[model samples]
Target chain A: MFDNIDKTDINELGEFGLIKHLTQTVELTQESSNKGIGDDAAVLDFSGYKTLISTDLLLENIHFDLRYVPLKHLGYKAVQVNLSDIYAMNGIASQITFSIGLSSKFPLEAIEEIYEGALIACKKYGVDLIGGDTSASAQGLVISVTSIGYAKEEKIAYRSGAQEGDLLCVSGDLGGAYVGLQLLEREKQIYLENPNIQPDLEGKDYIVERQLKPEARKDVIDLLAHLDITPTSMIDVSDGLASEILHICNASNVGCKLYEEKIPLDPMTYETAREFGLDPTVCALSGGEDYELLFTIPQADYDKVKGQLDISVIGYITEPAAGKEMISKSGHVHEIKAQGWNAFKNKS
Target chain B: MFDNIDKTDINELGEFGLIKHLTQTVELTQESSNKGIGDDAAVLDFSGYKTLISTDLLLENIHFDLRYVPLKHLGYKAVQVNLSDIYAMNGIASQITFSIGLSSKFPLEAIEEIYEGALIACKKYGVDLIGGDTSASAQGLVISVTSIGYAKEEKIAYRSGAQEGDLLCVSGDLGGAYVGLQLLEREKQIYLENPNIQPDLEGKDYIVERQLKPEARKDVIDLLAHLDITPTSMIDVSDGLASEILHICNASNVGCKLYEEKIPLDPMTYETAREFGLDPTVCALSGGEDYELLFTIPQADYDKVKGQLDISVIGYITEPAAGKEMISKSGHVHEIKAQGWNAFKNKS
Candidate 1:
């Protein structure tokens, strides 16, 4: 639908003019938003509930390959990543401030496309774009989003609240994003060597969408509330399942025992990993970018979430003296380790 | 002092390991911060008052030149720039989340130096470093900060509250930051041509510091509070005096008449402008990054702030029919236009 939009050079509109053009149609929908754009700062009144805040930075090449990633998906993913943090805390995402440092290479319409996707996400999630600042970059595009949320003081679930005997649960399936990335990389190489060859991604739409536009699992949070179950501790699985489990254990000063066979994985992801000559179990453990919430609940809450379509009971918390471990389907015990994505190592 | 510290490669530490090392010593002092780092999101409790939010993105090379700007000063200036917006809204900066995207070129110690400077600024401003994220970038450095503040419901200022016949006022001097930038660029070019020649910056400390370590006018906000004088409209002078005045006028649907002779300029700023063969008045009108507060008050409150040491009553708001104009020192009339920094044009 946006293919034929007029192309205007971003330079024709200065920073201020560009901001006006993008935000002129944004109508504030939140009762807490006292003021939105066109001010030194946005004013919000969250007098009844505790405020929650989170920030995430997304760089061009380090975070995603602009060569294959569409700008619209990139913008959508950026907002999703930050909102996932708020959801992981059992908070209602209310508003966000999205800032960008754009290079001159992006025309005004290109930026508008990114904004269109971001606004779509905001509308879907009922978030108000209260404030943001834009600037020029010397090189690639850079995006930083800060999400503001709220929850009752008693309803908030922190990562340091889990204890022994708590069941570990993860919302949504994992490893699909990683498998999808492999598909894209393979296609990219083929295109690089022979520009005329089309991508061989038929029937791989599930994994590809999982990689390009992962949702934040806000529905799972609401469902748990409706089911009258409160998790002891929670976090979003962004840096792979293993790394996130380690974070929860370290923060709560506890240990965990995960079952390799119980970790949720989509059938498409499993077959794709096999096709790529990779282990599906390892993909679920080490592959990142699955924005699923991982939490621990008491034994009494097991019946409340049992057989849920979106959640999986993966393991249980253990004493601190028992180091984190996992049990294989073949009845073998093994140490769990995190070999997830390390951004700095990629640069080095 | 840090020269002998361990020069650990950022790659070796990994993203999570590096964040733990850097933030191991951080302590949350704000009562509003219910939970700090080491969680999916930071929890805050802005219970009794309205919350204020603002964000800014700073990119290397586009916003600053490393040749003349120290990493420490750059970090300090980043915090200052964001806090200025809070004060402009008549609020006290309570907390900030500072995130950075770094490249492999920066070592662990270099990142530490930047954090140290940011901590110093936060300490000076009585704000807490609540949460942040670190990531790797493929290009130059990027810093994004989001500041949270609070103000009484009745005491907050907005850009759309100005009325005709209100007095226009400004805090501190203008144009020093722009001239300081010129001086630094000149010295940098000289050093590039002859590395051995030292920079000739003698007796220019005021303007140089203005550029390198500009402070947000929290004291001015406090003064206005103590004087029981709430501004009808307010904005910070990051985009020069003229642009800020225009923002107020546009938002408030009013016109303004600024007296050229009444605009404040440090004597050093005036001399430096003349030395560079530029007009001091024009510099004050179009130069940016001054980080001063421009506000308007009812004419009845004029006697209350008539002879303040740091404030100057520069003009008065006019009816929308009058249009925005500046009375030249030579008794000539000229329309005021915003020729401020255009980030996109700089790259184009």
Candidate 2:
């Protein structure tokens, strides 16, 4: 797709020149996007709508190991994670600003590869690339994606809107991304031990793809709208089910009772996770990077979501005095804990 | 000020706890800010208004050498540069998303110092700290700020709005940041050579402060509103004066003739440039990070802005065929070139 973009030096095109070259083909399709690119700031008219803004920062080696992660998938995932936040808010992402801090080791082609993936993702999601900053990093790559979306006021959902008796639900299966990550890590270790060996990954396509290129819950948001049901509270599961529900519980001043048997998991994820001697439930509870919507709805709306196969009711809300609890398959209740990633706390 | 915050391990609080601790005191004051922090995404209501969005990325050792830059000042300037872009479009910034990729080297206290500076700036500007993602960087510190503002439809300005015969104008003096950078670099080298001697920085406060904690031109935007003179075209001077003017010209499809005599310069900036064996005009034209607003107004608005104290009419727009030219102090006309900071091209 990026024909004749082979070996040209980045310096030859310069910063502004390179930016102009990459975004030259970008076309603005949204009427609300009154202006896109080529300005001090992009002008957007979100009159009569509630605007949603979210930002995410991705760091190489810390967020993804570049040895196993392709540059294109990295760029695409950066956008997906940010847009997932918007989707979790029950909003439609309309624009995104992609800023990158590239290190000296990267070539023009490498940056172009990343941009190509970002552009393709933006096109697929109907979001226009607006304004962003491009700079050189002294070390590794830094990708920052800020996604903007809009929604009708009545359709929006907040994490603090959950109430007692609301059904806790999740869209799509969990733990697949975590299982895929484990598979990739195993393959990488094998390659490190023997570079000449062609490592195995033939039938592990499902987990690998889930780990490498997780999609945002845009369709789930649309399907919810189509079903004429708005979630009482919502959040994307980027930091595992446990962390997210805890967040909602704290925000809403409510307690949740989660059922392990009701949690959705792919067959491959379960089998592969057990093969690695890891509990699949533990992986889904704390592994993260799923990008699936986790939400709650009233008991009245539970029947409406029952017909949807992708939707799974995993738990229900309770009074704040009850505290956040999770029930195991054997019927033991345990308090939920947050074991999410902390940048500063990692190893120090 | 942040005395008691000493040596708390970041992991002890975890990611969400750290973020909540840092932003707990962030009070939302903007009317358009429907929600501030603690959500899947920020909720902003910009009904009946056109919104402006701008983003900027700052990398360690690339944008600033932390050996001299205070973490607090770095944090303050990061938000300023991003807000300046929004102000250039004749918009009032209402919300911002601040994302940081901090390395393991920084302690909890160090990160809080940076956050303190950012919060102070946001409070001063009446912008709500909306939503952002924080992650661990394997390398150095990376700060990315995305500012969102609102502008009245008729009051907004664009780089492509300049017409023939429009008067080019600039707010505040230029080249101070470049001069300050030179002084800091000289002092750093001296310190490296001899640790015993305190580096000479007695009377260079004006320039040094300009570089370290440059403020966004929010007052200039207010002044323009007071004068009832909307700029025909505008751009913030993140890039050098020449480069920014060229951007405006390219966007507007018009030529410019900048008068060297009319370019405003602080006395310190001019004398410091001469001491460094550099031309003041060249410094103003090519040196960047001034964070001033450069704009154009119709010839009719000249009288409206004539009484403005800090505004300077440095040039006029010309026909496209005339091309971009600058008249020197000695009355020599030459084509203005883009010698701005091109991260990749600078070395090659």
Candidate 3:
């Protein structure tokens, strides 16, 4: 699929040579990093800080399709999603270990594209690429990333910390990634049906980029720290807005009322959803892969984030008796349920 | 393959339900583990110690053959191999995050069997299962494990610390895992040709266990600490004795002379090699997956570990000009070369 690229057989480099070639450019900048690649394990010093760890596994034909997704974008999105987990806990990511399994179908140059994207993400986020393993796969490509970070004990946020009467907030926009996927799949089908026609992705750059190269909401965490606001509960919006809200409610033994009209949606996402006969509200409520941060803070702390342009006050926490509900734009109250993104629909 | 077990559909539990069900019994026992599952990221307090992180990727049909390897054994062996990396650094493993991608061919019971074995290893090694991601694969099983641990700054060992006059030592016997693999493959071939035949595996339990259920050498680290002896360099023998010794030599800018007679070999491994018309010494030199610790220490510390039954002094380090060489039983000096394990030979 990577046309015009020199097809260097992966066997030419072998496992050790490939690893050394890929990691030769890594320059450790983290004070915590004592030793990196070329050892049995990476050594670090998280003295006086609580360490945070998160891992993710992405399998081809399951979590992603290489037909439309660029290898560079895939690597970048993978790192961002994992880093989002650390930021979701109000931590700063310091290092990441990435492991990949590839079939012989992949050339050395193809692997390099993926690692280049990964390194770009690490460099952009000021995170060190420490250690990882590479192996041959029996089928499609497989990627697994482990992100490590640190936070002060008092600054760490958990899902069970929300209290009644707290304001539920979200960062940036939602549903863009899900809408973007719809567009990509539609274009892929059209191309399969007619090879002569080019993909009509005009004016869809915003949502497409969101899907292919989403960034972790590290800035939001930094913003909260700068504002001296430690959120009572926080989670990244990786599983759609409604699902994340319900997670906070269930974990905290409370209820929530999310306002559909208040949910932020980029105009392009709404327009594309309408074009595809999909309800933009439903898309934002159920669509996933938006790496925005969702958090809850006490009502008294509202003034701290009220005027922040990137922050949105979308709902409020309620008593358990109230139940988890959503107020639609049409003035109807409905129970909020989680329709988690199922990437395994084809196989099952 | 798992006979006499209920084959509950994995889809019945969904992704979230399956994760909850599998991790329901995970009781965090480490003081370093401030928070584990049910969070965005696992929170660990390694405030006073340097942290060590290691990751490994295992792909079915590449790293293992499930026709003969049990699910539980695969799980246990996966954890042990990752932990062996931490122990190779002279560190105690404290936590592990395990991620697995499975095809729909697997039942919920099959997954539970794997997780059960993994949890057992964690309990036995006093490590906690903190966090991980689960997903569906399009083909065979894919497993990625990340092990975390800690050690005092002065107690950690690195491949670059070997000195010219350091004594080379190895723990446990070599060549057993490789021989075990040979026997299993032989049995598999026999069974495949004639299903009604009962494969002859009597009296081979030791080597078979070495291949299927190897253990990390945590006791050796504890013993070394008790004796107040710290090695100058160390590595786990996962890629054969020659490869590991060469790694130490290259990294430390030194050479070594390995004695064939001093290489510890279990009598079963030796006899099994002979039975297969393979040279026992060659197997010790090139057979991988032993999980034995190979280290180099100052010659002055030899008396401290001289009488230890598990510790064997195999050789001594020399100046770089001497080059890496191994002495045969007949006193013939031959240059030592690394024959690294290649699990991907079939694919690549």
Candidate 4:
């Protein structure tokens, strides 16, 4: 009763192909939908204001290994990660809907503890938990969250808004979250090899917390507002600094030169990178999950936000013909490439 | 380092505990959020209109076993199922955010076909597909959709609006979706036992379609508006008619008496029940996935909607003291109990 049709493997299309295929068939029915399917968030015209909507999914083994990550922090981080996208667009998150797929083996209290972490994050971030779905899973846990926020039409930021000769700025430190992950994974291996031996996590608290409990940089947006400086372009640092910089450059038809010394790196992150025998500079450039804001401001407004926020001027936007490159502390120039975490290739 | 903390499973707290834990920590920083967390959807006070947000998740094994289901139909049903909730609350869906957790085993074409099906439903319902997340899963496929809609504050309907002596009404035929599930499961088993046998499904098209491609009762909402009659309370018939009736009775603080004969049953559903040795009345009352509307209307406005829509007046609201019962065709009375599909209990 079944017709023979050749099925193509999902890996063949890659993540981009799957998204394009699924969204290509959609037609907008509402006039309020100004833009959909090709940005950090879907933009909607909410009368005088613009609304932004975005979603993210976290799978158990693939996104977070439960062996080292506690349920509560996992829950809290899930909501925070999604809100980071809204903050990336320079918007205030107003509400969120969370959905979870749980295995039947999970006890009731474990789920509550996860929510407890999520609740703490929500309270800290000033957003509301609106509505969601809960269901049973066959194997592992899955959490999906969609966040909605609003901003005035003029205050909204997009990756495509960067202009030539714009100043590049970054908030907070980089490489810490990635270094934290390394620390956790190392401790996990040590614990597995010998259960009686305790993990030696001395003086790595900052990096470890950066990985386990990253916060959305909503405060940066508030600070920009207070300083009366709106960014020409912006994006959240979730997929490594190099990849996000490339996104801004590609979207704005511009190139950038990032100074190695200007890239913010926490002291703990530097120490941990040396302990792991990895280059601290490489970790700062290509390591992911910083949850910090990467943005560009016009030359005229650079002084306005110079000291208003905890930001560092990393580079300057250039003409697209110049290409995206980074200037090292040793006076050597290297082309930037994205080697962010690819789940398909890395999944064990 | 490992901490000696007590471990608890998620099932012990149930769905409500998880929601409470997550929501209790949420802080509403935005003034636009008038209500959050305890309603069908988050109510955002956006100027003159109130925006409602809700989300639902459908997992392969938990929500639908693809062994007996088609991919395209499953995609269509997923969108319809979530929209059904928005319609039940007397709101029009404006936009949707879809997230899919797909296994690498499925071909790219198969995933595209699923989206094709979703596109069809989106057009029919006048909702825009705004944003979504695509990720690779280790096992089965999962789809989570969040819908946003709006309604005038005065026109919004809630489960608590039903008054005593109000009439209980339902739209279209019931129990067909449940019977349809049985028929499909039987055919699947037969085919699995003998691959050489050609199964026949032509005569069961109606029931099969009901099961595979159920549509949300958006027309009923429009019809009520056209007829100048508003439901006192409403909810979609997703978790079986009996279970839904109890929800209304419990929420509205009233009792109901359902007449078994008045319950609508399609001819295909009746024949399928007999073939399977199941009671037709029980199937009509306790079978789910109908996506029909179960609502209450005041007696004073009954004449306005009597023939305006495909409706059946199967019962009436009574004083809470009377309790919930069903009157059989042979003049027997039985207490109504909900035995709807419970994902938690059935997961094992």
The candidate maximizing TM-score is 3
lDDT tens digits, residues A134-219, model 3? 99998899999999999999999899999999999999999999999999999999999998989999999999998999999999
True contacts kept of each: 0.97, 0.91, 0.78, 0.31
Best candidate per DockQ, number? 1
Residue range A1-348, candidate 1, lDDT tens digits: 225567787888889889999988787888888888878899999998999999999999889887788878888998999999999999999999988888877778888878877888888888999888888889988989999999999889999889999999998899999999999999999999998999898999999999999899899989999998888999998989999899889889999899988999999999999999999988888998999999999988999889798889999999999989999999898888988888887677
* CAPRI docking class of candidate 1: high
TM-score of each: 0.98, 0.97, 0.99, 0.85
Q: Write the per-residue lDDT of candidate 2 for residues A62-102, one digit (tens) a residue.
A: 88888788889988888898899999999999999998888
List candidate 4 stretches off by more than 4 Å: A1-48, B1-47
Candidate 3 off by > 4 Å? A344-346, B344-346
Could you give candidate 4's per-residue lDDT for residues B1-348 as a string of tens digits? 002223343333333343343234334434454433332123243555556666788888888887767777887888999888878878777666666776656554456556767767877887766556666677788888887666666666677778988999999999899899898888888989997877678789999999999999889889888887778888888878998888888878899899999899988899889999999888877788899999999999888867754988989999989989999999899898887766665654
TM-scores of chain A across the candidates, in order, are 0.97, 0.97, 0.99, 0.86
TM-score, cand. 1: 0.98
DockQ for each candidate?
Answer: 0.88, 0.79, 0.79, 0.15
Q: How accurate is candidate 2 locally (lDDT)?
A: 0.89
Q: Which ten residues in a row have the lowest lDDT in candidate 4 chain B?
A: B1-10
lDDT of 3 by residue, B1-348 (tens): 767699988887788888999999999999999999998999999978999999999999889999899999998999999999999999999999999999988999999988988999999999999999888999899999999999999999999999999999999999999999999999999999998989788999999999999999999999999989989999999989999999999999999999999999999999999999998888878998999999999999999999999999999999999999999999999999987686545466
Tens digits of per-residue lDDT for model 2, B59-112: 888888877898888888888988999999999999999988886667788888
The global Cα lDDT (0 to 1) of model 4 is: 0.76
Q: For candidate 4, what TM-score does chain B get against the true chain B?
A: 0.86
Interface RMSD list for the candidates: 0.9, 1.4, 1.2, 11.9
